[model samples]
Target: MRIGELARLTAVSERSLRYYEEQGLLASTRTPGGHREYPPASVDRVIRIQELFAAGLNSATIAELLPCMRDVDGGPGENATPWLEQELVAQRDKLDRAIGDLERSRQVLDEVIKAATGR
Candidate 1:
């Protein structure tokens, strides 16, 4: 698919897709006319990339961590266990902090609404 179609499929902007390419998070093949052509699996990859970014993993870390997401049997490589476990733990901690922040923000909004409505 083309970049536009990939963006739509991935629910990401075209600019983001291009930026992902620039960040080395995504790869595409150029057509004879210089247009980028992405495989269908790029959609899933884009979604995964967005999730990783949302979890507070930077691009470089994501690039390293993506390869670690294989089956338990390690079809990709056996050496990814230690690094993958550490990275995943770090990502989880970051996500927990974000969730706590969001909960606090929600509570504040709830207080504001209750005050405004005299509840």
Candidate 2:
């Protein structure tokens, strides 16, 4: 399919798709007229890329990890490298800390609300 079709199917912007290609995270073939043509599986690839980015992985790290990873039922898989595993562990630790901090903040907010309104 064309880039536009891939974008529609994946719900990713065309600009982001182009950026993925530019970052070497995605690949596309050129048609005879030089239009970008993507494989159907690109939809899953785009989703995986978004997930890695959400995990705080940079584009370069994503580019390195994509080949060793798979999008299985919207989950990450085939993670076979020690470095990648370590990175994932670090990201999880960071996420856990952020979640804990948010939870504490929410509790403080609840206390303030209860104290101010006597409710």
Which candidate has the top score in lDDT?
2
Q: Tens digit of lDDT per residue, candidate 2, span 35-91? A: 999987788899989888888879998888787775646555566567776767887
Relative to the unseen true structure, what is the C-alpha lDDT of residue 59 in candidate 2, on a scale of 0 to 100? Answer: 98
Show where candidate 1 strays beyond 4 Å.
71-80, 94-119
Query: For every model shown, what is its TM-score relative to the native structure?
Result: 0.69, 0.74
Q: After superposition, how far is residue 102 of candidate 2 from its true place, in Å?
A: 0.5
Write the residue-wise lDDT of candidate 1 on 1-119 in tens digits: 99999988878999999999998888999999999999887887898888888877889988888766653233454346787888799879878988999999999999999999999
lDDT of candidate model 2 versus the reference:
0.87
TM-score of 1: 0.69
Model 1 vs truth, CA RMSD = 4.4
Alpha carbon lDDT of each predicted model: 0.84, 0.87
What's the residue-level lDDT of 52 in candidate 1?
A: 81
- In lDDT terms, how accurate is model 1? 0.84
* TM-score of candidate 2 relative to the true fold: 0.74
